[model samples]
Target: MKVMTVFGTRPEAIKMAPVVKALEASPHIQAQTVVTGQHREMLDQVLTLFEIQPDHDLNIMKEGQTLSDITRSALQGLESALERFQPDLVLAQGDTTTAFVAGLAAFYAKIPVGHVEAGLRTNNIYEPFPEEMNRRMLSTLTNLHFPPTAESRENLLREGHRSEDIFITGNTVCDALQTMVANLPPGRPPELSHLPPNCRILLVETHRRENLGEPMQEICRALRRLVKDFTSVEIVFSVHKNPRVREVVFPALEGHERVTLLEPVDYPVLIRLMRE
Candidate 1:
């Protein structure tokens, strides 16, 4: 059987890497990969790290891209890829716009969709904006639901999906982590150079679209207060490329001695930071 895997963005790529590898290793299945350039630079790095050469790349990212922009572009691009591949099953991972578009395209083509990392919900629709909605909608279109935990499987069951269709596959991020860890070089990566040997460290990575403006300010404020109170503690914030995020993050945390702000580091660097 031919299976097409669709994903975009760094997080989605990272989580799907192991799945792609597993699919390639399977003797009975032929796997194809399609990428929508939802996140250009970051997405490329993950693809390079995983050594995945996509069969199709829909260069859909645009400056100041709205959710509608990404959704529409991906839908159109995936329609063509779906027609070309004509796969028996379409697989999408996580809750990105590309994933939703992939499932939608597969539905239109009368092909079954296997949703990886399916059935995850925050319940609050706006906490993560379209992502929660994206996954929920994908669940409706999913023929095979690969939920990470029994809790997520229960979420599918409660939503009236068949128990047999919902499989507890666990999180693929853990699988990707194990692959990265096996290849890890010794010692701290250069990205964590600001660390003092004896200092307590906090590594932060947050860029949810819903957490912009006041919520972002509140988080910055809390971090400021944290560093002020704890003399030996330091904060390393892996900042996002969004101008809105930078506008708030830089001013509030940049000049502070205890806080060190850096651009998004590679997954290997992140794994080490999390380890240390």
Candidate 2:
């Protein structure tokens, strides 16, 4: 059986890498990979770390792109691929625009779609913006639901999803973490250039766009206070690319000696930073 796995974005790649590997290992299944290139640079970074080269890359990245651009591009691009490849089933994972659009393409082609990491619900449709709605809609079109946990399967059950179609696969995130960490080389991330003898390193990331403006300022203030009170500890924060976050974060922790605010590190560097 031929199975085409579609994913974009770093998190989706990380989670789906193991699934792709498993599918490749199965003698009965032939696996194909596609990357929507929604987050081109970041997606490639994770793919390289996982050593996954896509069979198709929909390189649809654009400056000032909107959600519609992604959906439309993935739909148009993946639709043609679906027609050409004609896989037995299309597999998509996570709550990303790429995942939903790929699954939608499969549905439109009258092809079965297997949704990995299915049935995760915050229940507040708009909390994760369109992602929550995308997942819900994909569930409707999918032939198989691979729930990561019992809680996720329960959520699907509550939403009237068929029990026979749901499979409890546990979370694939742990697999990625283990693989990356075990393979990560020494002395990465310039922020971790200096380690105090045998001292432990702690990594913190706080640049969620949702937490900008007042929330960001508040977090900065709290971090500053913690740095002031704690003399022995060192805090390294990977700053976001957004100018809004930079404006608030810089001013809030300007004079702090212990806190280091650095530019965003790549995935491998991030993994090393986290491990240190």
Candidate 3:
């Protein structure tokens, strides 16, 4: 049967790349990748890292786009793709807007939906905002729930989902890590490559709009305290492009000798940097 994988965002692509490879390797299965391009540039980076050429690119990103906009765009775009591709099954990864909307579209199309990295719940709906709600709704429509861990499987069970349909496949994030790191590029930045041997490298990413004000300030204060406490450790933070995040993180981290705040690094470089 043909399997169409719909995803957007870098993290979803990383986790789904292995599934795409597996489907390609299987003689009976044909895997088609569809990217919503919710995170146009970053999603493309992961796609290149995995050497995946998407069958369809729904460039749905818009400035000042809200959650409603993403959900509507992905649903409408992926619905057309589902009809055109006429796949036997639809697969989506994680709790991204693209994933949730794709699953919903497939459900409407009466195509079986398989959710990868499913069953993750903060339970507190608003803590992760729409993500928690997205996963919950996706779980309702998922014919196959590929939970990343036994704990996640148990969580699905507690939510009254069937046990037989839930599969405890260890987190595919680890699988992606193994595959992506094997062919990592060489000659990284001098600042990163020249760090002290075996020195701890901290990677910080913060981009939730709700945390822009006080929470961000608190995070900056914590980092400043951390740098002060550990003078020898090195930090390479990839600041988000959001002006709000930049405004808060940069001013707070300035003048710290050990911390190097830089623009976003590509996937391979970020992976290599994280490994060291």
The prediction achieving the highest lDDT against the true structure is: 1
- Which portions of model 3 miss their true places by more than 4 Å? 185-189, 193-200
- What is the Cα-based TM-score of model 1? 0.98
What's each prediction's TM-score? 0.98, 0.91, 0.94
Candidate 2's residue-wise lDDT over 1-276, tens digit each? 999999988789989999888888899998899899998887888888778989999999888888999999999999988998999999999888899999899999999999999999999888677789989999998899999999999999998989999999888898888887887777755676664555534466775546879989888877877767776667778887667888987787765777777787787678778776
Model 2, residue 134: distance off in Å is 2.0
For model 1, residues 166-218, the per-residue Cα lDDT tens digits are 89999999999999889888887787665788899899887888888998999
Q: lDDT score of model 3? A: 0.87
Clashing pairs in 3: none
lDDT of each: 0.92, 0.85, 0.87
- Cα lDDT for residue 214, model 3? 91
Candidate 1 displacement at residue 41 in angstroms: 0.7
Tens-digit lDDT string for candidate 3 (116-140): 9889988988768778888999999
Clashing pairs in 2: none
lDDT of prediction 2: 0.85
In model 1, residue pairs whose N, Cα or C atoms come closer than 3 Å (at least 3 residues apart or on different chains), thus clashing, are none
